[model samples]
Target: MSQFVLHDELWWVSEFSCESCGTRLCEHAGPGAAPDDVRQALLAAHGSVTLRPTGPAPGLVPVLRALREASGVSLPQARELAAELVRDGLAGTPAEMGLLRDALHRRGVPADVQS
Candidate 1:
């Protein structure tokens, strides 16, 4: 399994094969995050990343909206994420944090990714 952000989109691809039986399967998704299990495995292997706001704090509305769009989460989820950011930053895999960071920057909300 491999997942990363490319061309401003998340690319998730998984390949499964059996050497003896000569059977193979592949599942790939476009423009979105990987399944939770895959993401968790990556996070466990590479450690976690944190995205925190930097510079001056921005308005709540823009922050929430940026987070919502970046993560493709609902408004309430965005609020929770925003709260998490305010508390200890948003924590996730590198791809996720980086994508969120880009989104925040695009929305004029300064942020930094900590690995």
Candidate 2:
């Protein structure tokens, strides 16, 4: 059996790995759809995830903090990610966004994940 893993990092980076064959690929893009091959591999491996605010807008400060904590990014990068979260929403592998969702929730920013 083949085992695959999908990791969604800050800056819209997606890393795909297949344990069976030691194959790894990384895709980096702006705020848009993931590359077709990466998307397909992610869907096949861990499925898709959409993370959106469930309650009112959580304000930028808390969101930025959460983004930084979850992604280990610098303040500026986290700010950019927070902006994207508000503007375009967040999509990634379940575990990646799940961790962010949980982090935001802990900071009193309610969010939901659609898979």
Which has the greatest lDDT? Answer: 1
Worst 10 residues of 2 by lDDT: 1-10
TM-score of structure candidate 1: 0.86
- Would you list the clashing residue pairs of candidate 2? none
TM-score of each: 0.86, 0.61
lDDT of 2 by residue, 72-107 (tens): 789999988877777777987675687788879978
**Candidate 2 TM-score, true structure as reference:** 0.61
| Prediction RMSDs, each to the true structure | 1.8, 7.7
Expressed as tens digits, the lDDT of each residue in 24-83 for candidate 1 is 988776667788888877777789989988876568998998888777899999999999
Candidate maximizing TM-score:
1
Evaluate model 1: give its lDDT.
0.84
